[model samples]
Target: MLLEKLRAEVLEANLELVRRGLVLYTFGNASGVDREQGLVVIKPSGVDYDDLRPEHMVVTDLNGKIVEGNLNPSSDLDTHTLLYREFPAIGAVVHTHSEYATSWAQAGLDIPALGTTHADYFYGPIPCTEPLTDEAIGGRYVHETGVAIVKRFAGIDPMAVPACLVAGHAPFVWGKTPDDAAHNAVVLEAVARMAIRTVQLNSLAGVSQSLLDRHYFRKHGANATYGQKS
Candidate 1:
């Protein structure tokens, strides 16, 4: 039953990516981990959202091998698996070629922390990893993608920053579950859009450190608790 719930959540979140206009055709995918089952439920590779169904979601082990499914898992599975292995607390991951974020990635620019909306979720900027060399990009590319993200932000706190752009690629986000990860994807795209607009107005302008500190602390700091308490 728990596995079924995770599968359902993963399917629904994939559709939400389409609903938000964050993806074009079959450009994005979402996945949820069933930790007890030691498997991940993810969108099938190259499948259009209109054709996506609960049964179409593939089940795979942490190694990216399909454990159960008629279709193939997303090509980005290895990247997702690496993250899960490195961070047991993350139960969900989302990868999207969302327009605004991809624009920043194409330019090799980081998404600046621009407002309370951006700061509340990510304490600082959404980092864009340095471009991978041809050798690294050619071998075990997905795994190397994960390595780049970790190596780029080696000293930062992961929870405070849930997403990163893969240099010339798109954005990858992780959360406690696929639902949370999808939420981060949407938020990331929104902030990216804002940042792009802000740059148009004035490239030198950015969110003040004091405001970033206040917003992030009130929502995600040691003493912070969002939503209603249990």
Candidate 2:
């Protein structure tokens, strides 16, 4: 029952993925961090979505030490841990092999911000990390996946974008909370689907920087005007 609230939120976020069709047969996982406690709660590896409950969430420290969980953490624990360490601002992380996002990753291309929907969530095209080198893949790969993502964001703001497609793999997304990360994952898949169809109709069509700026800033930044003010 440790971190009962966090365990519940993480559980709900995982269920949200299934509800949104963002994951299949437990193919994805989500985690939330209690920043003050420096601990994480994540789904157990290989557990079916239908069978998951709050206590099923495994708790681990920032370094991946088990603090309260009886089951093993998700297979991607290292990646989530590394991200938490490297990107201090994020409170949650979500990984999903969602159809369209994974398609973009498989194709080794960025999902261009060709319209406003994408701009609303991401400040720019969703970047795809360079494919993992054979050596990196062979050595500490789960952790190396995070290394590649961190490397890709050298000059970019993780909050501004909030998601990255792992080349030839899937998308990893994070946000200020578990719910927010789940929201981004859902948005990323929607935009990815739209981007695919757009290229099919006209490969040259693209969103202008000015339009991208207008849409993005309306929902973000100090001057954000989207929705009512908090």
Candidate 3:
């Protein structure tokens, strides 16, 4: 079985999105990349979450060419591929239309770090990309979506933030693995919800930079000490 392990991981990550309520119907996709093999395993396009299987995961190369599986790859395969190609450190990518996160995307607003909950996962505000031009949308849209994300993170480190809202669209997240990517998707939604309520209660209030840095660093990177040692 070619890419058997990667296929299983990708399938589980996709199902995790559904199980966590980050996706409804087929509104999300998760992909795991095998950088050594130059292939990615992703959910099949439009497949029901309950009906998905390990073998149903489609394998494609960095150029988005199907390498295995009978069904078409996720409609966002190019988005995943472009990220993997551009950001070599990321091992997985997840795209979701989760309610709160998508709401922020559609509103064209960033999710500010309003509390410790937001700072624990995201280093600062979750940025929303600028709206895509008609010409870019008309061209290779999925590829353009990836380009938009890359453009938005001009000076931002993807590892520290790990997620972004696509203006007028949805949220895209990534991490060291498929499971990690899915986890970030869940966290993004939760923070987005809290940010909405936080603003409603006090529009001028936000997390102080001192607190944001303390919480973010304590849970992320080599200096992190929030959880048990590996």
Model 3 over residues 1-230: C-alpha lDDT tens digits? 68998888888888889889999998899999998999999899998998999989998899999989899999999999999998889999999999999999999998888989988989988999999999999998989999999999889989888998999999999999999999999999999988898899899989899999899999987888898996
What is the C-alpha lDDT profile of model 2 across 83-187, one tens digit per residue? 999999999999999999999999989889899999899999899999999999999999999999999998989999999999999999999999999999999
Spell out the clash pairs found in candidate 3: none
Once fitted onto the true fold, the runs of candidate 2 whose alpha carbons sit more than 4 angstroms away are none
TM-score-wise, the better of 1 and 3 is: 3
Off by over 4 Å in 1: none
What range of 10 consecutive residues in model 3 has the weakest lDDT sum? 1-10
Which candidate should be chosen as best, given TM-score against the real structure?
2
Clashing pairs in 1: none
Instruction: Sort the predicted structures by TM-score, highest score first.
Output: 2, 3, 1
lDDT over C-alpha atoms for residue 60 of model 3 = 89
**Model 1 lDDT tens row, 1-230:** 23677788999899989899989989989999988878988899999899887888899998888888889899989888888888777889999999999999889998989889999899898999999999998898988998888887787666789998999998998888788999999999999999999989998988899999888988875677666766
TM-score of 1: 0.94
**TM-score for each model:** 0.94, 0.98, 0.98
Q: lDDT for model 1, please.
A: 0.88
Report the alpha-carbon TM-score of model 3 versus the true structure: 0.98
lDDT of 2 at 70: 82
Pick out the ten consecutive residues of candidate 1 with the lowest summed lDDT: 221-230
